[model samples]
Target chain A: MREKQIDKLKDYKYGFTTDIENIRAPKGLNKEVIEFISKAKKEPKWMLDWRMKAFERLKNLKEPNWQKPKYPKIDYQDIYYYSAPKSASDKPKSIDELDPKLLETYKKLGIPLQEQQRLNGIAVDAVFDSVSVATTFKDKLNEVGVIFCSISEAIQKHPELVKKYLGSVIPLTDHYFATLNSAVFTDGSFVYIPPGVRCPMELSTYFRINASQTGQFERTLIIADKGSYVSYLEGCTAPMRDENQLHAANVELVALDDAEIKYSTVQNWYPGDENGKGGIYNFVTKRGLCKGINSKISWTQVETGSAITWKYPSCILQGDNSIGEFYSIAITNNHQKADTGTKMIHLGKNTKSKIISKGISAGFSDMTYRGLVDISSKAKNSTNYTQCDSLLMGNKCGAHTVPYIKNKNPESNIAHEATTSKISEEQLHYCQQRGLNPEEAVGLIVNGFCKEVLQQLPMEFAVEAQKLVGISLEGSVG
Target chain B: MLKIKNLKADIDSKSILNNFNLEIKPGEVHAIMGPNGSGKSTLSNILSGKKGYNVSGEVLFENKNLFELETEERAHKGIFLAFQYPLEIPGVNTNIFLKTSLNAIRKANGEKELDAIEFLKLVKLKAKNLKFDEEKLNRQLNVGFSGGEKKKNEILQMSILNPKLSILDETDSGLDIDALKTVADGVNSLRKKDNSFLIITHYQRLLDYIKPDYVHVLMNGKIIKSGGPELALELENKGYENFN
Candidate 1:
């Protein structure tokens, strides 16, 4: 009976794809494909040259085996390298000119792309499949000396800025997926706030995976100059499918002297169908560098949906008085597997980092928290605190915590704590006694378990994340 | 308002409440006094429909068979149990939880739901009467609350729920004299001609604040003695050693 109920919960919303026109590349990865993508976007020569070099790196790089997940060998020749709508190049100047089907899709997803245009203060970049469709509030961002646009457009228009900062923090060989993303990432948001300029409003990017055969490789970069500040949010979803899809994206942040950056992600990727038939393989690399004195960078993620997720948004504190923080809530149900956490590297004196991770595993899913905190010899008086907690829903699911702490600076104060426990039947009964149903009871307890991380999200996003948690773990209880 | 007949219950195959029987009518406050290891808490747990207890016998609330309902269903049927150890649900504010629970019960009973404004007004009135700090309603449900505060919170919940049969399961155990009096006063204010209470405690001191019309002594999983309110003072002075 329990197994049957678990199977029922495995199939959730966002598991169905719409039938729409799709323009896709031929199955293969080559220099020609890179040139084809660049030519399709009508990019400048320097941009083509960068893509060519990335292609070479992609060809030489091998898939990594260090992560806990079992990586099935992806057939680069069998996957479409690029896909978009047929008339994607014709940028819609307004919502009326946009494709009705595309607009309706975003509407159903509760993202009012049209309303965003009317909202003058906020800037929005909406990415569909492998390409960014529209960017709003450019003028407002420009007034504040903020450069926000698609990576493709940035590569063509601001080559100098892209050249100076791209892959600076996450090098080409940082990991297998990062290397792959560097080689073939089609388009993602890019933001650059000039020195001393604070972004006027929250910047947001919404990513939607529409095409079936294409893997999304989006590369995002946000650079906050000296004394500048910016808060960025990223949300993602994919069309439902039975076969597992792959999403390998990379994000890098650079915070200069006295600068601060808060990066938030609410990933609601399409998990597999019931019986664990098809879903997404989410492998992402995101890290920020606090490079100057008094700089701070924080990464907060609420990951409740996805078949198999392997991502760790990290921070590197490289300057004196720099600070780093990572708050995450990773939940898995059915047959999902998630291995996610963060890494904090302290190389400057008086640097500090804090990591709080909450993992929830229901059904037969397996969830793990893998993190590292490293204090270099020069990081005198560095302080770090890490806490990892997991809430197991049922007896079938598993939760594990693996922490690697290295402290070369004797003066550093580092504390690490971990705990793994199952949700007591008594708690569930208590919640049920308070007039909540079994599923609602489970949702309440799980939300309480991840309260710390969930509190870090924006108010609007926190509500959405809470609903997603309930929907994701719907049939895992009772 | 509530009736229990030959209520036999077991925890992990060990019988806790063996053929226990009690009747609570509207407007009446009955106190159950017992020694340690007695089934005072077990009776409360059973009435609240907690899981893992193999219960047999009949429990009727508001003329309806209570054992046939879910825990929440029982709550909706106006059966409320104030736990001795209220689970601290962090991140769930007391006001929000209480409102949700109250509205759920109201909705189940075919009553209209109260909006935030109305809820705030009701909670404020109850909090003032209970002398509970209004700020406590906004904090996470008993997350960092002291023992007295937790007991106060239970009374607060009981007051908001306005159940037909309210079971106080050692509600004054860890409370100070001031908090105990506050809690008892809260209970006293909530009492009505249509409501009833079953106060379960080890000491007779709680009865001093909220006088009970009747007292029963439960020992070794059964009620061994029953009498008027003076029975509590007798047990408190003589101890269960003489009776056992």
Candidate 2:
């Protein structure tokens, strides 16, 4: 019985930590800490001034408490704002020069940074703790006038592009957590697809939070020039810990005329133990701007981790004839709490948006689908469709759908549909009578419930998301 | 082969079955006819290993205790139950569900699982034999299906799995005359000297097509009378109320 209990919790496959040395800045959230992070990265004076501005604004900003999932008060002064592997301080010039320990860590996470073992046709930028250790396929990307590298390198190499689109979508003082990320943000991916160039390969970034007591705040920015398209995938995981850690990330996307951006994320952070003793407090802000005519942006995310998750990846449809879509599947189990969805704002004529969100709650967990669809008066003939579905496994858990819809234009149309259902005993017994085990039965039914959203993910990610969906509800069945 | 000795079942302290005894050998088709609330469904439920019943007494399948197994384990051991009320599971493709169920049983029996190509071919052949719509296989399982279509789908599944002991629990409940013949044809095609069937129903209409080797009359959870095919026609003429 004891062994079985341990085996049940072992469903989190990526809950192992690496024993690597790290260079740490002073703990706490202060000016010196922000300066230490900027100076440590050798950023320019303008970047330091920007960090200071965010810090000054952060002094008066209070943490938002209106979210459904409440957590203990986080002491900003006691948390380490910056922590990096000691070998990554000087920045390795190539994969060969990087520390083997970092490479091994990625390998264990099923993301190989080595060229020979690299995944086919997928460029990767690996971030360990507070710094990006290695980026693969740089020379090939550079061949097509595509810039795919770490944000730190972009600040020094393509400063003009970074400066133009860094805060263009998500401003510095957007919210408390976003503002904190802007102040002491560490390393994340930066991609720039030039005009008329469809990216040759899928661009991906794998994030690993390995250090203890350190909060991970990474900033990612993607810009697709006119008539260009890119599909970017982001995946993150963390080691199991007894203390709650913070992961506050800001992702911004900009698409030019006739350009499109597809962003997919598979967040498998280590949810706290069965008792919810410790886990990651994931509060992320992700948004995209369709700035040019006929531009499009779509966000697909599968969130099955974290103790308390609060995020809403949104879109600003500023271009005429632009399209925005948000497809999400969020599953919470074993005392986890998640309140996630999307926001679609139509500001241009003939803009269109679709939101499909699926939320599944099991065990003692709580899940909510909170979204907004706003069609402005100036956006004539715009249309929006939203569907929210929630599946509850047992009475101990809760699933809520909270949608805010607004249509100011007489010509515009907005339609919203919401539903709440439970997996019936008859369904389970039927599947079992047909020879499926209990866990497999639940997986099939839940996957069917989330089929509309799961179909939106990329092929490679769809398979993994399906398996994660099954593994997340391992112990929920009686 | 299956053997039951003094099997008793109760749900919520209400007696469902008491002193139930029967035996089925290979190559024999037996039909149990009973009126409503006569414990016909409870007997089938116990043999298929469904929960929520306080069961006593021993049930053996080929010398293995059936009560010690789970519902899925009993399915793996070659017990199939066609439910009276087939459930409609939304978003699960009928083809995919069949493939998963077939492969699970095959793997449990120490046999090599069938690949997609081989499995699809098998399903196609069986569906064609049953005259089931080819397009419906690609749809969500049982969702929006007519009563006749749902019953035919169950027969299609039964033919594909090819279990040793098949129990039809009110399989003729909602089927039409044409669908009933099709279901009987599907069952008759799968019948072999090594396969047995236990058909549980109210009327003897289905027994006319399949021709069970023996027929038993159940009342108040016990077999009050036992006879051959002639007994069914007699019951049909006399009605269950006056048969005993």
* Winning model by lDDT: 2
In model 1, which runs have C-alpha deviations exceeding 4 angstroms? A1-11, A115-121, B110-112, B233-244
TM-score of each: 0.94, 0.98
**Docking class of predicted structure 1:** acceptable
The residue-by-residue lDDT of candidate 2 on B147-242, one tens digit each, is 989989998999999999999999998899999999999999989998999999998899889999999999999998989999999989999899
**Which portions of model 2 show Cα errors greater than 4 Å?**
A1-7
lDDT of 2 by residue, A270-379 (tens): 99999998889999999999999999999999999889889999999999999999999999998999999999999999999999998999989999899999999999
Steric overlap count per candidate: 4, 0
Q: What fraction of the reference interface contacts is present in each model, in order?
A: 0.53, 0.67
